[model samples]
Target: MDMERRTLLGLAAGAGMALSVTGARAQTIADGGRAGPADPTEIIRLWPDGTPGGEGVTVTPIVPERSTDPAFHDRYAQYTTDPILTVFRPERPNGSAMLLIPGGGYRWAVLDKEGYDVARVFAASGTTCFVLRYRLPADGWAAGADAPLQDAQRAIRLIRSRAADYGVDPKKIGVLGASAGGHLAGLASARTDAAYAATDAADALSLRPDLTVLMYPVATMADPYVHAGSRTHLLGETPSPERIAAYSLERMDWRGAAPVFLLHALDDASVPVENSLQLLTTLKAAAVPTEVHLFQEGSHGFGIRLIQGRPAQVWPDLVRAWAARLDFPL
Candidate 1:
C-alpha cells in the first residue's frame, strides 16, 4: 500500500485506542480534561412567550451515546425542549460572531464535537460564538420539517438583534454548521421569507447570515445525491416534490445567499463529497464568493479531532484566512 494510505490507517488505529480509553469517561472529560461550570455563560431562550407550534410538543432528553468501533463517543448534553442559544464570549473581541449549529441527522444535536468544541476554537480567534440547541424534527415536535428551520431562523435573528449587547457587529455575523446542521444553515441563508409567523420584534430582524461555514454538510434533499437518513428524518417517508425541491439548497435561489466556506472529505461516506461539490458549483455559477477544501482521507465527523493530521486539521486556519480576505469587521 502507498505510504499515505498506510499512515491514515495508523492514525485510525491510534484514534481507536484513544476512543477505548476515553469513551467510558466521556461525560467527565467532555471539557477537554478541564473542569468548569456545567452551566453555559448564558442561555437565552429563542422565544420569550411560547414557541410557535410547540404548544403540545413533547421532547425527550438528549442522552449521550457511545460508539462501538469506527464511530467514537460524541459527548452531547441533555436534549432541551425549549430552544436556546448558549453564549461563549471571546476574551478579545473582534466584533464578529458566528452561530454554531451541531448536526445529528435531524434526530438530535451533536453538542460537543460539533458545537462547543468548534465554539472554543472560534472564540479563541476573537469571535463571539453562540451554539444553538435547536429542536429536532424527528421527535415529532412541530409539523413536518418546519421545526428545525424555525428554530434556526429565530436563533440568527436573536443574535443579530442583540449584537450590541454581545459586543458583536450586526453586519459581521455568520452561521456555521455540520452535516444536517449545514443544511439548516444553507436554508437560513437562502430563504428570504420567515419559516414561522413573526410574533415578536426579534423576528423583524433579518435571518440571513453575512457568511456561512459548512463542514461535511448535507446540501440537498433531492434524489440520487441526497443523504437518505437526513432526508427521511427531515422530510417524512413520502414528501411532495415541491417540498423536496424547496429544501434542495443547491437548487434554491442564490440571489441573496451569503458567501460560503465548505470542507468535506473525499471519502465522506455519511454525507458524500458530492453534496459539497453541488453546492460549490451552484455558488460559483451565481457569482457567490466561495472556497472549498476536499481532503483525500478523514472519512466523516472528525470534528476538531486531529486524528487525520495536518491536511484535515487545517480547516480552521483556512477559515481564518478566508475571513481575513473578506475584511469582516473583526
Candidate 2:
C-alpha cells in the first residue's frame, strides 16, 4: 500500500488533469466538518487575514511538485506564502495530536516521505496529525530565519484552539520533525518567547510542545557537524556569530521544555549522529526526560522508510513507545 501511494502524487497541478499520472488512489482531501480522524483534509490557512511579514511575498506556484532529483523521487511544496496545515486524522481517536513538520533543508517542505505517509502510519495508531507547510526563509519573508518557527508556533496554537474539533485532548499535543524540520521542532520546544506577535486568542495557548520527536535533525547550526545547506538557507551564506549561536538549538535554553525523543543513524552522512548526541547531552543537563537511539545504519531522512533489514524503519514504534512511557501515548 505504501509503495502504491509513493508513485502517486496527489493532484497533478502542472497538467491540470487527473489526480494522478497513473490513476492510483488519491489521498482524501476533506475539510473542517469531516466526521472522522482517519480521513485526510484539505489545507487550512494559519493566517486567514494575511501571514505577518509575508505581506508582499510572491506566492505563486503553490501546488506541490515532484522532486527533480532522480534518486529522491518525492514531492515538495515551495513558494509557500500561505503557511498552512494539512490534516491526517486517525481511524480511532486516541485523544492526542501532533503537529507534523517535514524537511527539505528549509528550502521546501517534503510532503510525502516526511509527512502524509508518516502521518497515516501514526493516525492508524489513533493519533491525529497535522502536516505543516511553513514559509521558507530564503523566499523573502521579513522575519528571515524566524519564519518557519512562526508557522510552527501558529500551527501548534491552531491545534490547541481547535482541539475538540479534531477530537484531541489539548494537553497531549506535541511535535514531530525531520531533518531541518527537526531543528525547527527543537527550537519550538525550547523557546520561552513567542516567535511572532499575538494575532488571535490561539496565541495564548502554549506553543511549546507537550513532547518533541526529532528524526535525524539538523541539530547544530554551529561548527563542524552543521548541515551547511540548512544553515545557509536559514541564516544566509555568512551569518554573524550571534546568529550562529542563537540558532544552534542544542546549546540554547531548554527551560520549561517538553521531554524529547531523538533518533539518528550513526552512519548518517548528511546530518551526522553528533547532532542528536549534542541535543541528548543538553536535554539531560536541563533535566528534561529524554530518550535517544542511534542506529548503526539507515542514515538520514529515513522517515518511516523501510530499508530491508535496517533498524531505522522501527522509528515509528520507537516513538510510540517513548510517548507512551511519558503518558502521551501515540
Candidate 3:
C-alpha cells in the first residue's frame, strides 16, 4: 500500500482499538441487525475555543427521546451542546471523503441512523466519513439560523485542512445530509463564505463541498410544503420574510455550487417531496450537474436500510455510481 493509504488505515485501526478501550459502543444497523464500524478515529470539537454565541451554555447528556421504540433507540441521539465531527476512516483509502450531517428538525441531531449507519456504508465503500454533530438552533446556542450553516462550513474547511492526515483529497470532499441536516448542507453548498467571523487558521480554508447529497431535506422555509417543526426550530416561531428568503435553498445563489445528488420519497408527508423537486428545478436552471430520484414508497428517514426491498435500498449504489461519474476517487 502507498504510504498515504497505510497511514490512514493504521489510524483507523488505532481508532477502533481506542474506542474499545474507552467503552464507546458500536452503532447498530437498521435492518440487518449488524453493528456499525468501531467508534470514529477522533471526535474533534467544532470550536475548541468555545463556540460563538455559546456563552454560559451547558451540555446535557443525550437521551433517546423515544426510548420505548426500538427504532428510536437505534436511530435517535440528542442534547448536543458541544458540536463535533466524529471521524470514521475507511479500511481502503480512496482519497475521497464525505461529511455527514444528521437531522432532527434542527432541534437535535440523529447521530445513529443518518450519521453513523450512513458513515459505515460509505466508509466500507472506501470513503472516509466524518459525522457532524452540529449545534441545534433551537437550543439558542448560536445567534441565528446561520448557526448550523456556520458549523457545516467549519466542518468542511476543517476536513479540507486536515485532508492529508486522513488520506483524503481536499478537492474530492463532499457533504451529505438528511432532513434538516440536508437543509444545512444545501445552505453550506450555496454559501461557502464563513458564516461566522474567522477565529483561527482552519477558517482560512474553503468551505465549498466538491459535491453534495441531500436526502429528504427540508429545502424551503416557505409554507404549503414546509416542515413546520423544522422551520420553527431553525428560524423561530415568527421568522421574518427576509430571514425565510435567505434560508431558502432554492433562492440561494448557485454560482460555483457543487454537483448534487438528491433522493426523496414522493409519499413523504413530513418533509414533502416537493422540497427535492424545487431544488432540482433550481439546480437545473442554473446548469449545475444534478440528479434526483423520487421514490414511490420509502416514506422518510430510511437511512441505509432496505425500504420495500428494491429501489430505496439501492440509493447507496446510485450514490457510488454518481461519485464515480464525477471521478471522485471513490
Candidate lDDT values, in order? 0.77, 0.79, 0.79
- Runs in model 1 deviating more than 4 A are 1-39, 65-73, 77-79, 306-308
Candidate 1 lDDT by residue in tens digits, 62-169: 445453333334555444466767778889989999999988888778876788778888988899999988877766565558788898899999899899998899
Clashing pairs in 3: none
RMSD of each: 10.2, 7.0, 5.6
- 1 or 3, greater by TM-score: 3
Candidate 1: clashing pairs of residues? 62-79
- Superposed model 2: Cα runs more than 4 Å off: 1-39, 62-64, 67-73, 306-308
- Which scores higher on lDDT, 1 or 2? 2
Backbone clashes, each candidate: 1, 3, 0
The lowest-lDDT stretch of 10 consecutive residues in candidate 1 is 18-27
Model 2 lDDT tens row, 1-330: 133443333333222321211122342222223222222434556887677896557645344545454333356777777676877777798999989999999988887788877888898899989998888998888898999999999999989999998899999999999999999999889987898999889999988889999989998998899999999999999999899999997889896689899988888999989899988888888999988988999877878644546767788888999889888879
Q: Point out the worst 10-residue segment of candidate 3 by lDDT.
A: 17-26
Best-to-worst ranking by lDDT: 2, 3, 1
List TM-score per model, in order: 0.84, 0.86, 0.86
